[model samples]
Target: MFWEPLRARFTREALTRSFVALRIRDYRRWSIAQLLSGAGAAASQIAIAWLVIELGGDGIALGAVTACMMLPTLLLGPFIGILVDRHTRRAVLLVTAVAQMLIAGVLAALTFGGALELWMLMALSLAHGVAFAADNPARQLLVMDIVGRERMTSAVSMNEVIINGARVIGPAIAGVLLVVSDAGWCFVVNVLMFVPSIFVLLSLRPVAPAGRTEPADSTAAAARPIGAWRFAMHTPAIRATLLLAVCASACYNIAVVVPLIVADVFHADGGTYGALAVAFGLGALPGAFFSATGPTMPRSAEVRAMAVAMAAAVLLSAGAPTLPLLFVGLAAVGMVVMWFIARANAFVMLSTPTAIRGRVMGIWAMALPGSTVVTGLLIGGLADLTDPRIAYGAVGLVTALVVTLSWRGLRSAR
Candidate 1:
């Protein structure tokens, strides 16, 4: 069903070593750029979610929009991975940043002009997803370029720190903007963040360690997506790693359900919806730190254990009878969620050979946000027809079962 990380106690030595990757200049620059870009992305997500709510859209509309946003990752993933291996990562990221900025700018104008229709938002979501399909894997490969193999796990964990940091700051900004202004202003903030991020990206150069690099092959035919997918499946570690991502993918994406919770269960406003996300982001920081101490190659047992912990946390949230309890449950979920993802990513990246790493990572990405194409419907539909709580409970229960049934298989390797 699902699997991921849990390991060595949080010793003082582990704590001190976590931030070591930031000591590298290029990684630091990349982190800052990612922080800005990730924040803008997060803010726009909040804006989009709020817009759906404002538009009188139901769970079905929410699921469809989410599906559109993630679909390109599934459809374009293999081809994009091949492209990633063939081209320069920084150039791809720059192009994506500019494209996403334009998309957000268009939405801002539409919002200001009072011309946004639900179909328009869905179409834009598709366009934005197409850009992100290129953005996600290229940025991931770039991290390896900056940090190299030895430090990749810690670097990835730190990257998760930046992402969770963005989650905290971005939604908080959106919460305020949405209250004082509207989604149009939030989209403007998205546009502004991209401008500086593009400049930061332009200023940096990345280098890989000798002999640890993906070969200098510039041909798309040199590293085929199909060959990569075959490698991932035939290899025990990668196959299991991909499976764990699928299992965990079922649990998170609470954004789709959070609004439904605030409106249907808590009878709260947009601000409360944002506050719940803040609790989640806060919890993720320590979890990301916990993951930072792990080796570049993760342990399967630990992966399985962490997946269970994450599932239990989701089920806990499902049973929350009060708003405060809901916050606690979601916080617990955030903790395990980041912890698992950081380790899982490290294992996948380290386990694969550099030649096909891009393509395999593409398949891996599909299991993540890409898998959301199918999951958005399941979770959103469950909430739509029944209570939102059922959606949460189903996610938790199904994930736990997947892990339990696949216990022996997950114990294999990467």
Candidate 2:
């Protein structure tokens, strides 16, 4: 009787459109695997940062380690994207998964054997970065291949939800593990987590690239290194979207800046910092779901509005007088920022042709980590010279200025 009611409630006509993408079998499998992989990745991030601290490394050391991790995305993203387009995406994903598994295992062994050093960690981070440079584009293109364009927006939004959920859960798990055991165990958990994803990828049927029926000769001709760049440069909508992404990336430096505020300004510990991160992730859940379920709006207006909202939230966070207020501000920031990201991603995907999607996404991918390197350096230097709060305020100001200046172009493009 209970099952009957639940089944009726979930009938085709009764279910929300936001979940329509999950009705596809391959996408469901991919999503589950992505969840596992995302959670492990998130947990590994916490473990890596905590490990650096435990090793008596200071802020500079942490920054260096992070830079090592992101540098490959900046350096190799274009080439990786081209490679993804030229080859089978599933093979790329499998290879990257195996490579990451091996890297994580090595890190775990080194840590357990007491042979892990800062330089070794940096080297491992660089290797992981190289793997991710390929993995990111392949994974994105694979989503489009499985679900097709109609459900692409929903799938992307759900993917963000999974990623944010993992961000919340992973750190908490890492924190607990660190309390009971150590960072090495966290790495071991990460290595084990990759197992399910690898198996899932192996089981999935090959999905041919959508709308891509070009002859081998044509594909080869278009696979030149500068092809993707030329396309992005000449395309107004793509160019505008990427520029907006660049601004969003700079604004996202708040991720690094907020931890500093929690520790230095709020006089809090690691647990408190984790709580704040969880709050942000929790806020992102509803934001992502709303974007997935809600009616489609004008992309330019949505982008501009969300950017303004994020700016206001950042300012509020920077000026927050109490921890409670800060939490509220951070939650608002997370919500709007995620909404912005979902819209921006959909806009880019919808604007680009399927033939060059991987290369375009690669460029988009580059904007994210590339901007991280830029904003990281900028925020770190400014914070050292003045206050973290001031650094955040400056970022917000720049974000607002960039969004406002681009308003007309984005609107006309829409």
Candidate 3:
């Protein structure tokens, strides 16, 4: 019985991994654009956060700013998904990238002019959030079209590496740039970085649109958007993966808690925070690179491995005591988190039909930022009341519980 199930699953997994559209040139161009876009996004985020703090904004303000940036994924994502299905994805991405550049340019101008305000900052963040909501689904859907459904899993895994690889450098670079000049320079860099993506999108030869057109009837077209959520909720594998992801996000927020711990508990300074982040980044890079090499087991097995890894990371974070110990723990955590992300993304890409790919991905995006935002607020409050260590430890416990409960669903996905 086990043999039969394993064989069947392997067949499906193999089909998912095979790339039918790899010969296409435009797709490669799109991938390059996406890689640059991810890097620019990371740079912009680090810069914006630092800008808030430098302008006398407190933790609460920082949280609000982060929330504003993510809130659109929850609010505008569904409709954006609909638009992605209805519009040319290349056009959509091109417009959004340009819009993002303009938004950053405006902020850069305000900062240079010394006219930036709390409300203006918040408003700009919200706009960026909206742009993100539109941008993400377009990119995800375009990937499917570019690579075809077969190789989507590998493509997604590789994409995660590209994005996170940029993340590893973006914050560190932002730190140095902020020290050298000011937040305005970061925004300026972001604006210039986005230009490459815009050029790539514009230069791509036109292909047939991958998205399906909406029905002529308003009610019919409106009815389709909500179905994506309904479908995800009903799918045991998808639902479980998302639940696991939420837990994973909570566990991953240890990165946030670590800096606070370094300052408050270890009585360290900025260098300590940088060291921990660097260690985490170093560890995550290898993990992401390994994930791109291919599945450890079958695809489903890989998914289950991610769930197990997440649990391990949570426990590691909770058990860390010394600064060196915590760095080691964080490195392990980073490795696992990277693996889990690659596996989870591959699962989603493999499982979803191309027609509804963007909306399904929108649902995926919703779970991540929504969980991160909630956990960030919860952890922030807990850290203030007791200690960052205790707060993160508690969150890790919660994360472990979530992973344990969701193991079966993950197993099925493989």
Highest lDDT model number: 1
Per-candidate TM equals 0.91, 0.86, 0.82
Root-mean-square deviation of Cα positions for candidate 3 versus the true structure, in angstroms: 4.6
In model 3, which runs have C-alpha deviations exceeding 4 angstroms? 1-32, 56-59, 211-217, 253-259, 262-278, 296-301, 318-325, 352-358, 408-414
* Better structure of 1 and 3 per TM-score: 1
Tens digit of per-residue lDDT, candidate 3, span 1-414: 646633553465543443323345766666566656666666667667556545665445656776777788877655676677677788888888888999999999999999998889989988888888888878876777667767566666667666766666665666566656777877887888787788877776545575465456668657666787888887878888788777777666543466567656888754455456556766777677656655533376666666677677756765677888888888888888887776676577558776565567767777776556666667766776777777777776776677677767666663
lDDT of 1 by residue, 77-119 (tens): 7777656655677788889999999999999999999999899
Decoy 1 TM-score against native: 0.91
Q: Is candidate 1 or candidate 2 better by TM-score?
A: 1
| Candidate no. 2 TM-score | 0.86
Off by over 4 Å in 1: 1-13, 205-223, 235-237
Pick the TM-score winner.
Answer: 1
Error of 3 at 69 (Å): 1.0
